[model samples]
Target chain A: MDFTIILQAGIASGTVLLFATLGELFSERAGVLNLGVEGMMLIGAMTAFSTTIATGNPWIGVLAAMLFAGLISQIHAFIVITLQADQVVSGLSLTFLGTGISLVLGEGLSKAGTVSLLPNFSIPLLTLIPIIGKIFFTDQSILVYIGYLLVPLSWYYINHTRPGLHLRAIGEYPSAADALGISVFRQRYFYVFVGGMLAGLAGATISLAVSPGWFSELTTGGQGWIAIGLVIFAQWDPIRAAVGAYAFGALRRLILDIQGPVLLLGFANPFYYNPYLGFFLQMLPYLFTVVVLVIGSREAMRKRIGAPAALGNPYVRGERGK
Target chain B: MKKFLQSEWMSRLIDALLPVFATLAALIIGAVMLLFLGVNPIVAYKALWDGAFGSGNAFAETLVKATPLLLVGLGICISFRGDVINIGGEGQMIIGGILATWIGLTFTGLPGWLAITLALLAGFLGGAIWGGIPGYLKAYFNVNEILSTVMMNAIAVQIMNFMMRGPMLDPIQAAKASKIPQTARLIEAFRLARWSPTRLHLGVLIAVILAILVYILLWRTTLGYRIRAVGMNPLASRYAGIKVPRYIVMSLLLSGAFAGLAGAIQVYGVNYRMITDGSASGFTGNAGFNGIVAALFGQLHPLWSIPASILFGALLVGANQMQRVVQVPSALITALNGLVVVFVVSSEFLRRRRQRQRLAHAKMDDAPPDKTSQPAEASA
Candidate 1:
């Protein structure tokens, strides 16, 4: 396997996951666990594909995708925040709603196959640089740079700003935050909206930047779940989340590059003749997620891991103290 | 007697009307979407109804679809009433099918009745094992059951995929033929005999019997009392000397067993072989999740769950017809299911609000009498 091709795929996948995980980080920090990221991403991918095909402007399509996903996720926020619905159920329902809606809307568009791919941006000096610059900065869509930029920007907004502190406080203890006159509802609404928009952008990256095509049921294949797991692996830190995404992305690419293996020491190795070993390897992320969750549940591991304190709990105004 | 009749009638009316109301509201929402799609909502719904229940065959299809749902829904009811969210029904069902297939393949010489019984037992044990893991974790480690169960589902899917593609693959098919990964079909006698022109089997009767048994297990037994008590308030139950953790584990095990039985019935009655990628649609097209919706709509009661499963089954059958007749997506059914769940959950809050309003009005009416009494007491 060529190092450069592997590097390219890694960067591309990492860009998609980074955007999704960063968005999820914001939502969780605001005390909302959005399990519907996959749904949002799927909606985003479909919208991006359709809009880009219709308008022939990848940028406009990306914008449309973000707005579409954000608007849909608003329903989730409305139920969880306003109606005090269970967050997990609301999130699961959001996925069903999003997937159902996208399939209905995207069916015709997918059949048409009119999606136009986004053009790559190349910087002269950066393109000439060695492996590091080639993988990170050159020969990628503008959105890749945008995704990279979002990491630190998200970190700043979540750690240094007043709104950030309030968001953290709401996640840690919504009652205390409400008592301090920070509107938990407004903060949650804002973060959820922002999270939805980012998720939309992440979906757009898949359709517009990475593949730039419309394929039915191809938009989501559990990358959203991986992004959620990345948020946990990063301990809710945005920058580290980006790193985790890149690592997962690299592992995925490495597995794809491995070929021609038929060594069997036992009676018969299942992997020796199986052509679908590649597909099984693709499932590594989910396996990793389960392993991390099991580890995270341990008392010693939990102390080291960071999760939003009030995550999945509804916050009502008058019921703050109680 | 008149007052008692009125109260009883009103209670029954509310109980019956709530699910219908929720279902109607969900349909209205779906209809609005259909209108947006430029399809006539009335025509679509009529198509759906005709598809699900128009003829003997269609009705049979609905019943067959509802069989697994009935089993899973009953399980959901039992677990949910005991305050355990057993989302792993799909996984348990898969494990059940796997175990049944294994037994059916290995013990070919056994008599039909004994073989079938053994298969069913294997299914129950398989599901119990799958579900009991999360139960043990939740009971002992304080692990969140929702996350743990969801994770187990993914693991079960992988395990099922591995078995179907690897060890359990049928030997008759050619290597390059792209055969469906399934085991050999069960012997004829071991299979469910067709009772009518339709494909409804004796398994439906088995489902009904299990439902009644679940009802008895949840409402009649001392163990049932302990489960309910723990569900109401674990701390209170603990103070009352109930082993809350044991009940949690036991309830989950029972839930899994019912789910496993559903899978076993599916294999022996319908599919007759374990298909590869059997769970691609996730829990055989989300029968388990829909079972949750059914259980909730049925108010977490086994007796009510039978009708609820039938209704959901009709919806499934109808959605397929609606897709063919009106050219609308079948996913509208899923959307409708979600809407039903949302509305049903919301009704509880609405009832609470109404109760609070009535209490406030009663207090307001008694305010002047209380004020006058307070003045008299002060003078005295």
Candidate 2:
């Protein structure tokens, strides 16, 4: 019911999704639909959690997470890009692998006791503004602040930069890009590695800031998948993805925030009130994801809006496909 | 060029050997990982092998684990071959189990065969419906099956949780103290009969028969041809006057039914009661994901999934035993399974590359003599 409270919390929590969506945005734009965002996120989360615990520095944890995840994503890049395996299968298996590896490595970190999560702070100049400042800029985690800067930076990078154009060109028509002397394979590998590192950072945000600490397959609760969905829902646009992520974050927060009142309000009939009514709240975000995906897909297909032309297919020079 | 990877027979040979080589390579990688983790790889593997296949009892457990995997993998084969990824097997399995549990609990005094048949049918139908939702969306609305299926999984889990805790709470447990999420034991007549020593039940037979059935349905039937044709080239299939969407729906439905059967049989044959620990893994044992791994290892063939599932089953059983003896967490096995999947998929990639190379070589060789055949071969 408190709009500001929900908005603040949504921005704080949605940073995880924003990072993931941005990461996926890069990979998809490069024409390699890396579905292993979830996997990379998990690896990042585990590395960040454990590293932060060991080194007592959240920044160190973030760096390791990105490094480990980016390094691991080479396996995916090898299979999908260089080897030309099915991207979806490779991505799913990467997730399965990532989840397994992270959990195996992270099992002891959580039980090793409480670890320091990245704390929130407000900018002095920005916090001094009116109601706008309080709603938009106050007391946010460093990740959320980074996400805010990331939005415009990504937008500019994707739409304005020379390298961004080349990335887009390769994704849309690798053969044409190859004809133009662009190394489609190298560019794809570059983006996949970069995207994977971002995904790792997203996972670090979850462990170090969002949820704090680590749990077995903790990110498996569909956030990574939702982040992938956010890419589509954003029509592969950066700013749009940011809005979508925050909106989704708000929706995710609704599950925890609404258990008491929203259900009671939605089901006005007294007979519908059950003690376990709150259990259905857990299903909200997933259901929302499906609904959003359907609509996003409908829009994308209807208008042929914003997807890269050769999104899921791997490129093999001089090889014909059925 | 030394006849390297040439000829269709040679390609087939590689296809057959690829999985074995991949499995070995993955095991080697796993061994390296174990060594890095400060464990003795040989001793650990010995424990794993002994645990999975050492004795008659262990072998029986492997069969038991393989049963559900084989069924689900076969189901996934249908969907994957049709180019529709039905990742919602976990949801399908959960819904199917609940349906079977309901049938077992609701119906009484019926003959055992009739009861079991009805229960199985209910489970299959439940899973089919659960799967059909994504299928229908993909067919009519162009929705992504993978994401839709994932969403369906979440909804399915919530539904199971609500039902189990609310109305379906084992009446006996309702009467007593209960923290564990479960239903009361099913009626005695509905329980699957087990063999004396192995304790493996009728589900193994069902799995074998269904595998054959899937193989036949995929290769022998016209529906199968249409599905394959659609999967190969939807635009071409559409041009050829095939209804592409229908095949997509059919594949997903069939896949869901098989997954549902896996769930139903697990309740009847192994667990004997419908229970969940409020996590997808606890109820489905990650069988949904494992099934995908099996299907991939099997080269998407139902017949091959039998051995693939068995191999996966052995790994799981072995890993559990290894965990107990070596003090390694069972999570390591999951990571190991992921490793196997990656290796198998990568091997598939290499195989395809080699096939492409062979085709290119063959084209060049025939270039001078086969001017007339060039166009025909290009299309073929």
Candidate 3:
């Protein structure tokens, strides 16, 4: 495998998680755990795929995807905030609904034929660098560059800004935030919806940029949940989450990049002849996730700092000790 | 009307009816979606019901669909009662099926009943181990089972693909170079006895019996009480001398066992060969996830899930009939089922609020007689 090429692809794929992790981070900060990341991404991917196909414009595709995803997220916000439904159940239902609808629509859109993939452009001097620039700064989609801006922007927004503090307060103790005149409901709704939109854009990153077409339940191949996992792995910090996402992305691509050579050279020996070795390698991403989750959370589970104390609780006005 | 509304039986009746109402609302929403696609709602629904329950053949097919669902849904009820969500049912079911397939193929020397029983037990163990992982994780380390279980589903899928394409691949098919992923057909002695003409097998009876057993286990047994208590309040259970974590793990084991049995039954009874149908769904045919939908729609009761699974099963079988006649894709069932789940999840919250309201009303109704008479006396 070409190390630079692997890094380039891994960083590009990692940007998908960057958008979703940042979105989930913001939502969790505002005390809403939106488990519908997979669903929203599928909806975004489907919409973006068809829209880009119709207009032949990837930018329009991304925007439409974000808008549709944001709209769908409202269903979640209303169920969680207004109806006071269980966040997990509501989020799961959102996923089921999103995946089902996306597949149904994707059948028609995929029949519309593939659209032009998102264009990629490289920086002049950065592109000239031997390996480092090739992996990080050059030869990535515009979305990856946007994701670059987002990592620092989200960190600054959460730590240095006024609303960010309120967001933290709401997540930690909604009653206290309410006492301080923060509309916990409004803030949660805003963040969850924004998170959904980001998930949508991330979906478009798959369809319009990453894999470059719509596939059934394609976003669910562990990306959304990985983002959700990264949220916890990062302890809800955007920068740490980015690190986790990139590492996972690299790991996800590593096996694929090396499998061809390994198979041809019989490097894996007796197992090399096994046709199913590919499936075992496919298990790496998920197995690694379980390992990371167990180890990362071995000691301080909930007491881990940066965990939004009221993360999954629905904020009710004047409710004591909720 | 006022008297009927005020009657004590009314509340009980409403509790029973809410799920029905939710199911209807879900179907109606599905109908509207159909309308948008230029199909008449009346025609589509009529076709659905006819295909599901219209004849003996359809009912038999519906039974096939409902069997796994009932088993899996009941499993869901068991785990949820202990406050553990076992979303790993898909993986559990697949592993169970694979193990059962192996057992049936390897243990052919045994008698029929013994062979089936051994295979089923192996299946149960496979699922129990799979489900227990998340249970143990949640109990000891507080690893979120939801994340773990969902991730496990993907892993399970790969494992299934590997087994089918590699070690478990039918030797005959391998020699022929067939790409179809499946095991060799089970030995005839191990095949489940079918009620002729109707494809119904003994698995339906097992599913029904298990449903009752789960209901009894949940409500009549001490284990059930402990599980429910832990689910209701872990702190209170701890105070009352219950080991919350133990029950949590046990709940998941029993849950996974039930789901594993479902998969084993599917292999031994319905499909007779373990294979993927090549859809976007996993080998479990969405049964693991859909069982959650059924359990939710049934209000998480084992008994209620029977009918809930039937309704969902009918939708699946009937959707095929509907597709034949009305040309609406059967895939729409997933979306329709998703809508039902959305409604059902929210409706349960509404049901709880109404129960609270009813209790408050009863308190007002039983208020001091003197206070009640005072209002009349003051009016006079």
Candidate 4:
């Protein structure tokens, strides 16, 4: 195996999942589980693709993607918070709505040629470091660095800041937080919106940083769902979530890498059918997520790991007291 | 008694009209969006209507499309009534199709009636097993059903893809063929014959009968009572000595069975073969999610699910016609469906607001004049 290439691909895939999962961690830790990540990402991908094509600036495209995704998430917040609708259903609906809207809006723009890819940034002196520098810093897009930096920043914000404390409190027990005069609705919406923006940014990273172009349906290929699962595996910690993303990303790369060899062993002349094997191999992360979830929820594992106390529960101010 | 009758009738009228109002509001908003896109909203809607239900053929197509939807919606109604959201209907449907296909292929020489029956049974069992796994997990271990079911759906899709590509590939097709993955067609005799030139088949009748069966089961049986009691309040049911977990699991299994049967009927009655994509294209299990809308719009009652499913089925059928006439994307149909779900779910909030308003009005009516005057003066 070419360790350098494998490492680079791993980092790239990790950046995609990390950006989205980190955003989910923010929303989930704030006590609202936004299942609309996939939808937001889909919208973001379309927005970035369209904006980049129209303006010829990748950064503007990235901004457009985040705004578009965030705007859609506002609808999610409206349903879950303002209307007191079921968050799960609302989030799922947002996804379905976003996917449909993006696909419709994106259909025309999908045929446009690729924009100029985001230029990579290399830190001075850091570029000289051996395998680590090459894998992480050298020739990587700005979004990649930003995605990695978010892990620690999110961790610090969630654990070390007062707003973080309030966020966690609202998620754990909104009524208690309300008694303390925290605006539960405001916090939930705030985090959900912020999470949406991050998710959008993560999505734009795909079109601008990685694929650097437009693509149609399933372009994100269930990465958003994988990010949701990663939040659980990370146990609501941003830094850990990043690690989980990277691990899954690496696993994805490993599966693709072994596809040829494995298929060759199972069937003669596997090179002829490597593409089919690769397609099936792409499903590894999702299958792995189910396995992990099943194992993680086992009695032994449950003792060690816990979900956010208020995950998926809708918070109605007065109802909480009862 | 006269006043009570008037108020009751008024409330019933409002109940009937609320969904229509909600749907109109959603379409108006959607039209405004179309206008922003530089599309003529009126023309687009006309096309959608024409394409979906303008002619006998279009209406038949709509009914054909609605068959799976009606079945899946009824299935979703069953699960939702138990307060368990089984979003994995698409997956369950796919598994049902796979099992039915497997049975049809293996028992090809059997009499037509027996083969059809066996295929349908296999489908139900397949779907039931798929749906039951998540239910069991939730009942036995308190695992979140939403996550489990969603995960299962993803897994099921992958498995379907794998099966079509590998073990279940038709022998006639060369291994190298790039044709879409699908099972062999069921025997002609086993297939549901069209009643006329229209594509509508026996599936619609079966769907209606099943909906009625569901209503009877939910309203008449001891099992139904336990399911409802568990749904209304699991803690209360447990305290009342109901096997809450068992009922929860049973509801999900029954829901899955219905969904699976829908898939089988689609394979035998319509498609005649299991396709790689199981109904994301309005062919099979989009009906599953649509069933959620039907269940909610019907207020989670089986009796209501029939008309609700039909209404949605019409919308779906109409949307296709609208697309052809209006030059708008058919994807708008899904958007409309999402809008319906959003509106229906949000309607509860509107109901609560009205209730609160009524309560405040009643409080003012009950207040003594002097006391009311003093409170009013304080407020002023």
Against the true structure, whose DockQ is highest? 2
True contacts kept of each: 0.17, 0.73, 0.64, 0.42
Of the true interface contacts, the fraction found in model 2 is 0.73
Stretches off by above 4 angstroms in model 2 are A128-131, A260-275, A319-322, B1-11, B360-380
- Candidate 3 ranges with C-alpha deviation above 4 Å: A128-130, A262-274, B277-282, B369-380
lDDT by residue for model 4 (B1-380), tens: 64553354665676577777878887887898789778898888777667667898887787777778778778777787788888778778888988988988889899988998899999999999989998998887666677677677767777787777667777655355665677677778888778787878888888889889988888899998888889899999999999999998998998888888988989888888876752233336477677777777777877787777777777788876666666667777777777777787777677667567557767777977763345555667
- Candidates by lDDT, descending order: 2, 3, 1, 4
**Which of the two, 2 or 3, has more TM-score?**
3
Q: What's the true lDDT of residue A105 in model 2?
A: 76
Q: Is candidate 1 or candidate 2 better by lDDT?
A: 2
In model 4, which runs have C-alpha deviations exceeding 4 angstroms? A122-131, A260-280, A299-301, A318-322, B1-6, B175-180, B277-285, B358-380
lDDT tens readout by residue for model 2, A1-322: 5667777788878888999899899999998888788889999998988998889989999999999999988888998888788899888888887887887777677787767778789988888787657766898888889999999999999899998889888888888888889999999999999989999999999888878877777554778888988898999999999999999888777667654453354565332434466567778888888888889889988897767988988998976541
Residues A111-209 of candidate 4 have per-residue lDDT tens digits of 687687788888778878898888887777888888878888888988999999998898888889989999988988888888898889878988888
**Candidate 2: lDDT over CA atoms?**
0.86
lDDT accuracy of residue B219 in candidate 4 = 86
Model 2 lDDT per residue over B287-348, tens place: 98899889988989999999999999999889999888876667777777777778888887
TM-score, cand. 3 vs. native: 0.95
Error in Å for residue B318 of model 3: 1.7
Q: For each candidate, what is chain B's TM-score?
A: 0.91, 0.93, 0.94, 0.91
Cα deviation at B261, candidate 3, in Å, is 0.8
Whole-model lDDT for model 3 versus the true structure? 0.85
